[model samples]
Target: MVLDAIYRGELLPCENNMEGNGRHKQAGKEIEQLLKDLRNNLSEEDMALVDQMLEQTLIICDTECSDAFQYGFSAGLLLMQEVQEILRKRVDTAAHGVF
Candidate 1:
């Protein structure tokens, strides 16, 4: 089932529709207000530089989030494999009357 979903392009980790926590939402609002305030005070050139920095920061954040998701998914798969193997061994032992 999971493989079929992946094959159909349905498993998107980074494209979630969930909202961030309250603290993160508040921080984002504060950042937006700060940017607006800065826009009124800073020169156009400086604002452009700030925008470039923000863009770069966003890129870095996206890369980090993607890498983290990949790592978590790999870890989950390994855990599932381990659980299945343990269960299989238990079943085999029980069948052999080894308790």
Candidate 2:
């Protein structure tokens, strides 16, 4: 079943077709920006963030991935929920020159 899921995902035409592929590229760019913001503090690269999140989320979800792998998707996604909020707050604060 896991193999089937992985296989099915491989065949998704979104790569050659564009039913929903565009969303991911946009999301990727956002993640790239966030990771860039983060890399200012850490030493990791943007691609490294994706690689780490994929590996971590797979371990975290431990689901029966299929063409619709339900492993809930990302380590950073979970982290980002919180981090994004914090960053926003920091930005709001910094805008006022409060540091």
Candidate 3:
């Protein structure tokens, strides 16, 4: 199943397809401003260290977002399965003329 493929890490999530709302844009702007401040105030060596730190943070965030997406997708599939089971039960009951 496609879900199994995803769970097995065979299918990769597309990060580019993820869209954000106004709050995301605002937060990005805030981060940009902070980075700008750091660039202006910190020494070259310190800025290099900050850049490395940011690179690591980006990796962590990317991993977290991917995991969250997979988890939500799995949850959605389970919900759909539950709905289908409920509908099947209803159909069965109706066929038997049961209330």
Candidate 4:
């Protein structure tokens, strides 16, 4: 999910170079770090899925021509939500021994 979000965030809708500078770059870097952390912690299978998602998302993001920042922000939030959901589910399952 983090990977997907990063890819989505990276892709821009415009040819403007400004869209890829400063704030957007910082956000992309942050997202990349989070994705790395997630990769380190998840199971191999999960990681593989995430990798695939990330690849697809990145392709989309690359071509996106408008609202790159907004898309990036949204992707970051979604990544956060995905991580939270994963952790919550893991904890809940561990506590209850059921899904």
TM-score of 3: 0.75
Clashing pairs in 2: 5-66
- Candidate 4 lands at a TM-score of 0.43
Q: What's the lDDT for all of these models?
A: 0.91, 0.68, 0.89, 0.81
Model 1, residue 58: C-alpha shift (Å): 0.4
Order the candidate numbers by TM-score, best to worst: 1, 3, 4, 2
Worst 10 residues of 2 by lDDT: 63-72
The lDDT, on a scale of 0 to 1, for candidate 2 is 0.68
Flag regions of model 3 displaced more than 4 Å. Answer: 1-20
Could you give candidate 3's per-residue lDDT for residues 1-99 as a string of tens digits? 988987998666564353666777799899999999999999999999999999999999889988998899899999999999999999999999997
Q: Evaluate model 4: give its lDDT.
A: 0.81
Q: Is 1 or 2 the stronger prediction by lDDT?
A: 1
Candidate 1 lDDT? 0.91
Which has the greatest TM-score?
Answer: 1
Show the lowest summed lDDT stretch of 10 residues, model 4: 11-20
Local error of candidate 3 at residue 25 (angstroms) = 1.6
- Considering TM-score, which of the candidate structures 1 and 4 is the better prediction for this target? 1
The TM-score of predicted model 2 comes to 0.33
User: Considering lDDT, which of the candidate structures 1 and 4 is the better prediction for this target?
Assistant: 1
The TM-score obtained by model 1 is 0.84
What stretches of model 1 exceed 4 Å from their correct place? 1-12, 15-20
